[model samples]
Target chain A: MSTKITNKEQVEAFLESYDTFLFDCDGVLWSGTHLLPHVVETIELLRSRGKRLIFVTNNSTKSRKAYTGKFAKFGITVSENEIFGSAYSSAVYLSKVLNFPKDKKVLVVGEKGIEEELESVGINYIGGTDPAYNVEATDASLASLARDESIGAVLCGLDLHLNYYKISKALLQIQDPNCHFLATNIDSTFPSAGRLLPGAGTIVGTLITSSGRTPVALGKPSDEMMNCVKEAYHLDPSKTCMVGDRLNTDMKFGEKGGLGTFMVLTGVDKEETILGTNPLVTPKFYADRLGLLYELLQNN
Target chain B: MSTKITNKEQVEAFLESYDTFLFDCDGVLWSGTHLLPHVVETIELLRSRGKRLIFVTNNSTKSRKAYTGKFAKFGITVSENEIFGSAYSSAVYLSKVLNFPKDKKVLVVGEKGIEEELESVGINYIGGTDPAYNVEATDASLASLARDESIGAVLCGLDLHLNYYKISKALLQIQDPNCHFLATNIDSTFPSAGRLLPGAGTIVGTLITSSGRTPVALGKPSDEMMNCVKEAYHLDPSKTCMVGDRLNTDMKFGEKGGLGTFMVLTGVDKEETILGTNPLVTPKFYADRLGLLYELLQNN
Candidate 1:
């Protein structure tokens, strides 16, 4: 059974229980280009209440800097330091957690966000958004294909310009026994402009199937993402609450991290999903929407 | 235990047992650009014995016509009717078995081979090497992306020109409840110029993960390919022998189709793979290489 946080008392109690709040942006705060009602007010209220806010998103398509710009578009103020997207998390995991070698470069099979994050972490990378790799591959190209010996890792994410040349290069790079394979996230699909589009998982899944190797995925629901957050913030798990709309990524991530979870039915999951048998992951608290928290807090 | 046919008597006995022979081209007949010695002699011998020869390949990159041209280059003449490549098989499966509606067309995410095969069957298709769909997709393009309502199926195969636009279009088309999702083969990698390259399965696997739907795969190790061959040549499974280099695709295909399987140690699988305990699928007979049959026949 999940507690429904509806009234002002419940909202105040919930707020008092957690000093740190981790939010999944896509579903809870907004959906696609439309911002959910009262999100700006609720977020501001939480900020005023001294909540340490962290926007943790599985969208690896955008860097922290880009996310800050997107937040501004939503009429919300957020610093780059407050954002932890899968691209940033993956870079953190590689540079900080894995202690990726300085001499070697990562062969990226993703978009510019990944490259930007890797650059922020001072990690040398090749192939992401490279015009040479974006072209159509032929027999001659495939035959003469060569890789830089410095490529020690293959990092992949949601790549819009995913081409055979890139996949082939990544596949070849990962063939070396010493090469590490990493993925930003394995999100199968994300809501986009009123429809579900293929996500990073599709790209990673293709590589996994082609290369017959699974990558170390750094994103929501994975302990690595949680670990990245924990190491960066140095926060106590018990004092943190993960608020999101999805069960598999957000709620499961919270549960795995041993943090309190709050499910907002503004995203992929529904109320029945929370109450249903064999639920993927049960949240500690459930709400009709994130705006409900705003109404509760305002009334108080 | 797999019986290893070594001598003239053993080879003669093996040939006499099966009326039809299905050969996997790459490793058995040739590897890369070089034709394996004695393959032409062996194939000629089989034809002289009144045996039906069917070249069954999981390589969807080429149509039957293209395969025939390749065979000609190897000094071995094979008609398009004798070739059952994944591209041809998938086309046959959709047009002949599925009896796809004439009013509707297939949205292809593959190479020119698939387009040729579909055209040969008089099936209307969009995409597949079309310059419009091969371009990189942008936010503007994705927003303006439209689907042809007449697209009732999404067919995929090995596509070097795979891009976001094609994947997105296929993803959207398959969203229709009535649209059929079809794949030429799910072979993860295929031998190419002495190295393994990502195959059609990689492309199809991406769509499968993204769409959250599995396609009806029509290639080696699946009965659909066998059905295609049977329909084309009137093959009786019991009297047919599948000879190939790979255990998983070729041998497994033969075993699943209830045909006698002959393992040729010239391609992906090694001798230990067939002799090892807990083998995936045991072939009915084994040989050092397909050329050994030529030697045995010549000696006889």
Candidate 2:
């Protein structure tokens, strides 16, 4: 049943037959805005071959609209649907499985992107709404929810307003075995515009550390997210291709979906990582960038 | 030569000579607010025996004032000089070693404790005034600093607001060989009120990870902190007993100082850890809590 082959030739053959393509934004396309020279042309070339392109990023700090804007800045015209971020996928999954609670008492403590996702998903996002953004207010609001009986489930995502107290409140509520604890993703950290920022994963980690319990991760490399890609795109596993930079997130997504994975060494993951550390999601195709990948395709 | 006595009695005989006690605050005395029953009495008992006590925490979050206040709230009275948290030590070390520039600019991303320490050390903290308080502000301020040449060192500690972007910026500053990098402590993570919070070690992890450069750690288990404790108290290591929860931090502190390390499984480290993990500092005496320790002391 596992059609996923590690052989380069077999994967290339599969890519030739696939109708849909998935690309990881960071490493595969460009390493955070320094565009590889021929990437746009390569996508255009793939489009000419009747391949559907989907750009996915595990970084949930940015919403799809933000991605669209960033892509616009990067000179790539990507539709909101064509781009799938972990935030988007997380939101979509929570909406479907979590039977939108009526109490709508959610203690949201993530970035603007996560807040946007929650509101879009029909879940009542409730917590400290300080324009000044006070952690004290966030703490009290969350603690109030924890003490409340109406609050059903606790939804967690990447919160830019980070702290120990914020997570303390969320764990206070969700620690009850009756409640469902769903996380945006399991990425412990992310590279942002700042120095280094804790991701939704860190928040999720907070909950796990406090309660000694794991939350249901709704985003990338999780079986659920992979299925989302499969069902929506109607992916023929043998023919589909996944191109990404990170071996764990992007490449693993391909592995789960039984597609050929291409690792581009442009972003977070180094060249050595593909060969050295993670053996689970090793890429079938290794390229410097997506454009370079297309160049190899063309030269051959 | 290593001590030849194997039985627990020899440990008691050895500890009888020590005149000063170096105690790690969190894991040994208590895990957060809940105190080990005999902790106060044991300290009182030790004090009655004419032993000097210094309570230390590797956690860089709060200052001596905060710890003093926290202990006061728990109905314990201890002097400021008798306390040694990583934040205080780092500040003291930085003030002595690092040459200040004309602007007095340092980018800070930790909590109140680390802030107090930095101020005490005469470090003019810049970047977002709120240490990892707001994401947008934290990100914007840090991103600006990453590109700024005026900024000297990115001073970091245990900021519960830890994330990827901030670490990225710290790395950016550290990437230049000209920049000085300092970590408050090297504890990978810490147990907070609810969950596992990223420790000062994780902050250091970002620098070592991105720039492939190790930092100068000024906190616990680092000979600097140990030496600071010894000189401040005028104590003989052979006669003193070091008590704490963690084998790595507290026990190691005792071990490195050549003091008798007694581990109490009441805080961050458990008895399971003693049995499983190879502690760098092996406690001459090990027990469940201060009460058990008291019983052992009487019998031995």
Candidate 3:
């Protein structure tokens, strides 16, 4: 049976048990643009309790700087260093972990966020947000497409500007045995404004099928992202707790990282999913909403 | 043991057995812009033998009319009626088999070939080479994307002009439970000019992942395309032979359709693939090249 962190004592004890709190933003903190009530207060309370706050999000469309701005808009102050978006994580993994060559550039099939992250990491890249690559290809142009030996990697994300020209270029680039394939995340759907849209996985999925190659995905639920987070923050998994609304990405991520998990009923999953038999992921604690923690803090 | 027809008597006997012949163009008849030697003469010889020759190809980028032009360019005469390109097959299946409602439109994610085929079949369609759908989506424009209730189906093919707008529109249109999802083909690669390029499967794959739905694929190796061919040509499977270079697509297609299969070594597959133990597909006959039959016709 999972412990329900409802009362002041339960919430206080839960907070005391963990020194670090990793949060998934979209569902637990807010749903779309509407902020979930008391989330700001709860986050403040965690900070006041000396909890190391790290915002871990699978949304690869935004860079860490962009997330900081979003946080500022929500009246919560957060620095770029505190945000670990999939885009930023991917850039870090490529630059630091893989030691990507300085002479070669990454072929990006994503948005500005990915480009920004790659730039921040001092990695040269091509294709993302380029007007030249965002157009339809004709037979004449296709024949004229020259292979660039400088493209050492193909990085993919959710690109609203996805076109055959970009896909074809990436396909051609990745055919080289030396070129690496990487993806930000494979979340099948993007939850926005209370609706599901096609996510980065759709783009990556097509590349996987076309190239007959599986990319190293850097995001939640992937051990690679967890490794990046652990190395960057020097996090002790035993002292960390993952708080999120989703079971698949957040809860699975926490479990895989050997951290305590808390599930909130404000996102993709419901209480029935937790209570159901043969659950894919079981959270250590369950809360009605993130706001419940704020009430516990106040009452305590 | 598979007999290799190297001489005149064996080729004459093989040709005389099958009344109808299905050929895969890229490998058997030609390789890219350069037509294989003796292919034209062999085709003419088959025509003289009164064999019903059908050019069945998974290349959805070109319409039957375009194929007729290509055949003419290769110094061979073929009519649109004798061509069964995946684009034409899909259109025929949608119009003749499904009896699609005349009032609703098909949301197409493909090239002008698919559009032309749909037009020939009198099926109304949106998207495809539409200039409006060939660009990126903005946050403001994404909000403005509205559902078209008149869309009854989503057809995917080899779309060189693929954009997020088209994919998003198709995703929205297919959300209607009444809408059908169809694909021209799921060929992973297109062999052109001695190289492999991304095929229609890559386009359909992304849509499948995004929509969480599998489309009814109409192409080689799929029973749906076989049914369309059967209905249109009134083929007697027992007296028909499917000849091509690939074992998986062509031989499997022939075997599945209850027709005799002939493997040619001039395309994607080699003799080693056919001679190997536990082959995925077993063809009834094996030839070094399509031109072997031409030599037999001249010698006999």
Query: Per-residue alpha-carbon lDDT of model 2 for A1-300, expressed as tens digits?
Result: 123333446435645766878887765566544766788888887787788998877767678887788887877788988987776776776677566666656666566676676677776665533343344433244334334556666767766554445555566667677767777677755555423444566556556655656777767778777776676567788877787767778788788778877776666776666666546666776765566545556553
Give the per-residue lDDT digits (tens) of candidate 3, residues B1-300.
567888888898898789999989988888888888898889888898899999999988789998899999989899989999999999999998899999989989998889999999999998888888766688776766778888889999988888777777787776666789999999987875555678899988888888788899999989999999988999999999999989889999999999999989989999999899988888989998998899876774
In the predicted model 3, the residue pairs found to clash are none
Task: List, residue by residue over B119-179, the lDDT tens digit for candidate 1.
Answer: 9999999889878887767998787776678998999998998888788888887777678
Q: After aligning candidate 3 to the native by TM-score, how far in Å is the CA of A94 from where it should be?
A: 1.4
Runs in model 3 deviating more than 4 A are none
Give the per-residue Cα lDDT of candidate 2 at B23. 81
DockQ, per-model, please? 0.85, 0.13, 0.75
RMSD of each: 1.3, 6.7, 1.6
Give the candidates in order of TM-score, highest first: 1, 3, 2
Residue-level lDDT of model 1, residues A1-300, one tens digit each, is: 789997999998999999999999988899999999999999888998989999998888789999899999999999999999999999998898889999999999998899999999999999998887876698878887765689989999999999888898888888776899999999988788988888899899888998889899999889999999999999799999999999989999999999999999988999998899999888999899998988876673
Q: What is the two-chain DockQ of model 3?
A: 0.75
Give per-residue CA lDDT, model 2, range B117-206, as digits (tens).
777767877543364434444545655644557767777776655544555456566667777777778876666454444456655554
Question: Candidate 2 docking category?
Answer: incorrect
Listed per model, the TM-scores of chain A against the true chain A are: 0.98, 0.83, 0.97
By lDDT, the better pick of 1 and 2 is 1
lDDT for model 1 comes to 0.89
Just chain B of model 3: what TM-score? 0.97
